[model samples]
Target: MPIEIHQSDPQSYAVAADFLNVADVEVVSLQHEFGIFGGNAGDHILELVQRLRTPLVTTLHTVLAAPDEAQRRVMNALIRSSARLVVMAEKGRQILQTVYEVPNEQIAVIPHGVPDRPFLDPAMAKHDLGLADRTLLMTFGLLGPGKGIETAIHALPALVRNHPKLIYMVVGATHPNLVRHEGERYRDSLVALAADLGVSDHVLFVDEYLSIEDLLKYLTACDIYVSPYPNAAQITSGTLAYAVALGKAVVSTPFWHAQELLSDGCGMLFSFGEADALSTAVAQLIEDDSLRSAMRTRAYARGREMVWPSVAEQYLDVFSKVRFERRSAGAMVIPFPASVGEHDRLPPVSTTHLASLTDGVGLVQHTKFAVPDRRHGYCLDDNARALLVMSELAGLVPLTPQEDQMTLT
Candidate 1:
């Protein structure tokens, strides 16, 4: 259901909240971005969330290192209202803990999801696109000033000087918001820049929004992928994630996501807006076939964890845990024995259930009656909880032979 974007619509918020409360959702996953909700810094979201009766799992799309007063207030309120907070990058988790003083347990770091695709030769895809002869360098996503497309365009002259057949592909249409106000002015300027730099033929702009199939096609066709975003605090980037997942050799600016994902030799990074650095990195990767191939191999290996299936399981785990916790919160509680002797009289807790749920990765997050639910996958939180329980149990009672074997496993 759609609610009108009015900054202070109390009745609208209340109605939306009431609808959701009665909708019988097990858990609500909210995607939080600053401008999406209506309010000063999206504070209007607080009104609706405050009225929610269902468990809330908020996925924060943007986590600012330095939030203004209004943004901070809205974020704090949202944090209080959410059962769990999700961020796509670890830097976001760090910022929430350090800057906002949020407890680490409240947050989960899940990478942005990417399509499951095979690592294929760029030549095959380039031939399919009728550009087999030229070396392709691509940057995709909605075209806007913040994308730093001009830097890539500026770097084109230096890149072309070495790889004479190089063609920089600027894919994707102008951002709707930018088009609404500026009417393709940003696209026009990039074109003009290319012309002025005397590399007009080397820069190609595919001015249209692309479907995932087409996006992947373009991605596969490119020999080198570049993300020149100038914002250092950009916490997540779906395009960047896709590039890494598709095994494309990447050269990106040091945005938060890039800094984390591109680390450990998975990809290359350059300072934001540094055209010379961008050109150098791209040239280095292009010149050294082994280096580029190794980067692709490492990136593909890392992408294994970020694939859609793995990410979906992670989300299911979070949702299942939230629902379980909510159900548990309202259930009857048994009072514990007061004295040590009283506790000693109680039978030792069985490790059977815990052992069944645990696999090599960690403890699975949920179970169906007596069976472990592997579809829900595992999470760090549950593993930590299991460790704590086992530590306490070891001190309280000697493990049975079977339990000892389970623990060793």
Candidate 2:
């Protein structure tokens, strides 16, 4: 399906409703991080959703457990605007329902998606990465404070002593956003801490943005993937999800997303900032090969449900429900006003114009009366309208492939 990209400025809410006027656009998929901390971007998103005539599906990137009055109001407005809400964890769903008063039916729990990759043996990967005979432990992704990397580094000193052959690889560069404002302060601090702990040689910092191919190579080589993020409210971690999906044993802090993904023997989790617990979790997994292998198998099996294809299908299901509801609503005839004339009610809101406006791809957004305008592009709104009209009239009109895609969304 061909996708139309409409760019909207994040800081401005003035033109939030303009996109709603675009033709043939059936549904809007919004990614939201509800906050004013970063230039009131979330407010802009909420404004857009409020003005949208098409159905909206919002994937909330952050779900605050203890939100303030303003935050709560914004989240409530967002939930109301959205036809369906996608959260990456069940914990996030609970937070929305309990804290924000969102209906249980309004939320869909979809796991963070990961790419499908063939499982590679860690020993083979270690050899390929030139770390022969060494026990590899790793944590990766853009670096910044609150990542709890220092806690992971602090734990390393004791870990290296128990297993002399162990090497901890701190992968990826400083987070680009953090670098723009804070320079290298966080990375320098982690490096300094590793030096102070006398584990500098054991801790390898690979400071560069890794390509997906290279990242998977490094992930495949690790005996255990550690995500020592300290934030308890964190609802999603793509890095952690990727490691789990690739069949690697994981040791992570008990953040909300981790609590969900790591449950049921899929991975090990420790309390936030607990280096002793973190090290113990890693050491236990490292010592027991059978247990580690079991974790990898379980994680990989669970990950299959969250792969991109699976996630896409789940999204389609939500979109279909929204489409059906809209169609049923449109099919109902509104009561005529007391001032209505006989001529106005003669046509009975027929779908004739909608049928005339459609072509092979879908219904065009703009037209000169009943004639289709080719210059204007196909849109989700018009396509959705066409679908509703067609559905109400049964098989009198059939939806094109593009129209079908729009209605499904």
Off by over 4 Å in 1: 1-10, 328-409
| Ten-residue region with minimum lDDT total, candidate 2 | 2-11
Model 2 ranges off by over 4 Å: 1-17, 35-38, 332-409
Model 2 TM-score is 0.76
Error of 1 at 219 (Å): 0.6
Please report how far candidate 2 places residue 133 from its true position, in Å: 2.2
Q: What lDDT does the true structure give each of the candidates?
A: 0.89, 0.82
lDDT of 2 by residue, 60-144 (tens): 8888888777777778888888888899999988998888888898899888888888877898889998998999989998888
lDDT of 2: 0.82
Per-candidate clashes, comma-separated: 0, 11
The C-alpha TM-scores of every prediction are 0.79, 0.76
lDDT of 1 by residue, 185-287 (tens): 8898889999999999999999999999999999999999999998798999999999999999999999989999999999999988999999999999988
What RMSD, rounded to one decimal, does every model reach? 11.2, 13.1
